[model samples]
Target: MATRPASDTQVLAGRPFPLGAHPEAGGVRFAVTSAVADAVEVCLIADDGSERRIELTERTFGVWHGLVPGVTPGQRYGYRVHGPYDPSRGLRCNPAKLLVDPYAYRVTGRLTNLHAAQGFVGDPARGPASTVDSLGSVPLSVVMSPGGPDTGAKPEVPFEESVIYEVHVKGFTEQHPFIPEALRGTYLGLAHPVSIEHLARLGVTTVELMPVHAFADEPSLIRAGRHNYWGYSPLGYFAPHPRYASEPGREVEEFRTMVAALHAANIEVIVDVVFNHTCEGGPDGPTLSLRGLDAPAYYLHTKRGHMADITGCGNTLDAGSPTVVRLVTDSLRYWTQELGVDGFRFDLASTLGRPRGGMFDRDSTMLTAITTDPVLSGCKLIAEPWDATGEGYRVGDFGAQWAEWNGRYRDTVRDFWRGVTGVRDLAFRLSGSSDLYDHNLRRPWQSVNFVTAHDGFTLRDLVSYNDKHNEDNGEDNRDGTNDNRSWNHGVEGETEDAAVLALRTRQARNLLATLLLSTGTPMLTAGDEMWRTQGGNNNAYCLDDETSWLDWTPSAASEPMLAFTRRLVRIRAESPALRQPEFFEGRTTVTGKPDLVWFRPDGEEFDEADWFDEDRRSLCLWIDGSNSQARNREGALVTDHSWLLVLHAGDEPLDVVLPSREYGETYKPTLDTSTADGTPAHPGVLEPKGRITVEARSLLLLRAPRDIVEGPQTP
Candidate 1:
């Protein structure tokens, strides 16, 4: 390799103490672990563009290390190492290519044009498929300043106590009335007092911001002049996407400010982290970060040197490698320790558990490390426990420390409200899908209940569209999921009929009631309370237009949805019976009756056959408030303020029975979704079973006698 001026100023001071680049007592120490490199060179470039080279004199345990005394922060540097060019052995080190600091906190330059973006495709000039060495065309690495102290403290709320509101940073407050026009789509907007106040009002304990890390537009979208609105394609893990951060501070600093502000408001900040793969993509993709750093080391690959395409993004990360695992762990720690993020909701977390035989390892090193790491121990770790890979769906398999996004809950609730008979599927969902997650002593909160999330249709769209309409997404409407399990409510798309609109509105209420009122840690997709929509696009991941933004000026149909959501949340907060941490034990310890009573419209206890009957829709669940798993602030066991939840499916009203509480408490009407304020219009004494009319596609909450207790009723 020729010694260019870019490689000629600083001498390599080999120090093998810290693995990756780190700030030592005096200056930064850069180290990279490579098992086969014959020699490692550190090229330091000065501010004036002068460069010096130093060959590392030492190699310890396959790790090349160097500590430059005067190499301060912001110093431009790159590494050149001599190793075999055997592709079969997975060694592709080319001394001519300047490699990036695997642990760089910040980068200063652009891709030395697009060729540098090729990363290590052999030769980009020959295309990504060529086998020739493409070292000269890739970009060089630069040293970055170290992150300062952590900006905020963790809110430290328990998983059961958390009310996560997932939002797209750009879409969330962009159309809000109070946010400034300039700051509407940026991080500052999320941390703005107006945004915080709204969360406070909604009783949100955490804000799960979707993909704030730097990301790139998918090539297909870029070709169509569209962009990935969901921001799942991560380009930089350490830096917040500059576009989301508006002014003076760097991406990390801007993110810290947002977290600090949220913490100040007593709300925690959770980031949706995409670590399954990088924006570099598949064989025909960009090679900006990991691919350029060390393709085989940073990514999972077949024996043929081809990257494994499991994440559906072109490649899957090699979590089995120690270096790769360290990279992921370090990135997580950096976000939690330096950026003050309260937690992470891992995107496609199953990829992180990939073991030796391509099967997911429940006890993978990365999973164990995270669950045991002190810094991350207190942080809320959520997992979207599946991926496109065949063996990657481990939904209920994650251990006690991890909370999973219960896709089953979402599907079951949607199906039940859509009147897809045999609600027995819903029985498990309403109780946290214990069949999937009950092996451990995990509570119901372990199932993070959600009806609709960012990846799919909004609450409004779910009941308004039977199919996705993503024509504007520039993919010929072929990009999104075909099976949305949604209903168009007597019409396929938008409708003018008042009755149809009313049904759609009521159906949205049903979904919300099922989610918020069910036992679990509920997560509301932001703007669902106001019935946000993506036109009819179920997958708006690539649409940056009005299709993706949350328009605060809601439609007429949205008002009722919003009111219903507020009422549902308030009721959940008011009733300890609804938010019980543990699963119902069936028999009540106090009354000796079932802790939960399921009834049909005829006031009969649900039979084994009724549960399996797919055509049976309407059902009532009577909750014994005295059996609540919570206590007041004084720590006394909560007493029965009994509540009856009546649910009806289909398009006609039905008379449902409210079973009498074993304590002889009477039923009083409290909240009715069929009404405006969500308050019931009438109250009546409890018979052996009291009957109430339930509107089609509606959920009603009926309270029991509050204070007056009844003496034992004679049979």
Candidate 2:
């Protein structure tokens, strides 16, 4: 039980419509949702560390409200919910724990003492409520002025044409040479000219920032002297993380500036959001905001009153409830409308779809709200498409208006480049994955394709390492996934062998080219284009030091790869054949050829029986864009150049015969992965039936000419 404050502060009954602490003309109206609290007090903390408590006298529909006079902007405050301490019933509320407002737009501090915030005295699940005052140790919510960002014109790039680049805010800017020393590793640093210039040059239309929502490091990590550098354990969804802001007390403004800079560069901003779970862990975890307010209503509980740990993060929010739906949608609208973010990439999104009984539903309340919200009408929504539980992998299961991270696309492409498969599934992956995403009228762009992401071996590492080396993470080399479909070309880790090094570069190019040229929207991991590696550490979630920070220095491997990547992006942008919104129809075109055809190296088209040839390692994807069945926004047919992409993953070089004149009269070399910098190995044009040798473990991209052509291109 909490004693009332000593000082006399006038408190009036405030209306409870919009939740959270909002400052108006008279004062700040504080409203908190606690379905099971006996009484609630808005504890105002002074700058000098003293606290004044004002009890909210009005209770309407499980919400407690009060208008505390004289409370202005920058006033730090918390909540003390007085209620039952019955863990068996999932109502573990204790006034001793200072609770943050679930709708707080800005929080000012970190939880220094973890144990002091726990509600129980002995065993956390069965013991009595502790009386330790968590006033000075816990984080406090600050009242903010209702001022939105001065965002200029929004780029609003169409979904099908988007090329996403997933980046970490700190790692991307921490070592940037041109960023100021003071601003490095901050949001303003990312907004700087050099950062924007790099992104613009890379041709990425969207930057999916990893978790900008305020998060807390795990207590286990704190005890081990490590940090959760990924920012997945969210503490406040509405706030821009203060750790990334250069100017203290101005995180919202700094984040807005970063968004504005990206918009100015014709890029969209998409934040990775974790709304499934929070920093408040399980039944034994600390008494954070949601747990202290009403654990049963805020968290999913088992029949035995234990918190459902489906997220593998302890507590899973009961998204089926109307309260949780309102919470998530409100947070999304705030980020979209106030701070000026263009999109969101939902982390562990499968849990949100599973609103009840641990069963996933496509039409859950939370999903429906986001899909229907007018505020989020045209915003891009990308889901990670899985959760911690084994049953949460719902790829291609998302309904209308939502895109999913295509895991199958990544696996198939990696396996194909590593010579681990025939071109059966590889063909499916390369041509929009129609089998997976063509249901319910989902287009090819609905499958966000990638060969590598934030939590796996990088593109360079995928070709250079066969096993994970996570010993630096202090997990005794027992962290990260083991099923890496990667081939190290008979050499593991770094080596001095010239042949092996050349092979690794080519393999990397093969993977990157496949990702960029695929028919779905590609999402490239940051720094992968410049030969970035984590020393084979697939999981760098806890390592915040230089091991995780992106090295911005140019080197022998970095410069060539960057140039190659830039050229590839340009090729993809210029070539409409690669950006097909519709899957191949196999229909005859105006040129008396099929819209899509798979040809063998012998200049013969692949028959139906050729798909089951398990030993075959080469295939050609021919796209006839001139008679393409795809349409623009106006539903008019688009016509572009026809293309032929050749992949030969065999150990020996093989001579490839160009297709006959039905597709095109001659072939113009566009890019060859065998070259060190994606240069054309064949500098001159080759006529029909001509033979060109594709070296071991490489790919070649060629375009058909309307007439005579000028040889291959140089980046």
Off by over 4 Å in 1: 1-8, 12-14, 17-26, 36-58, 69-90, 94-100, 107-116, 119-150, 631-640, 661-664, 681-688, 705-715
Q: After best superposition, candidate 1 residue 148: deviation in angstroms?
A: 4.9
By TM-score, how accurate is candidate 1?
0.90
Model 1 C-alpha lDDT versus the unseen true structure: 0.74
lDDT of 2 by residue, 217-331 (tens): 7877877888889898998888888889897899988898888889989999999999889988877777768999988887999887888888888989998988888899999
Q: What TM-score should be assigned to candidate 2?
A: 0.97
**Against the true structure, what is each candidate's TM-score?**
0.90, 0.97
Cα deviation of 395, candidate 1, in Å: 1.9
Q: After superposition, how far is residue 280 of candidate 2 from its true place, in Å?
A: 1.4
* Model 2 lDDT on a 0 to 1 scale: 0.87
Tens digits of per-residue lDDT for model 1, 619-654: 778777656666555545565476777888867888
After superposition, the stretches of candidate 2 with alpha carbons farther than 4 Å from their true spots are 1-7, 629-636, 707-715
Worst 10 residues of 1 by lDDT: 124-133
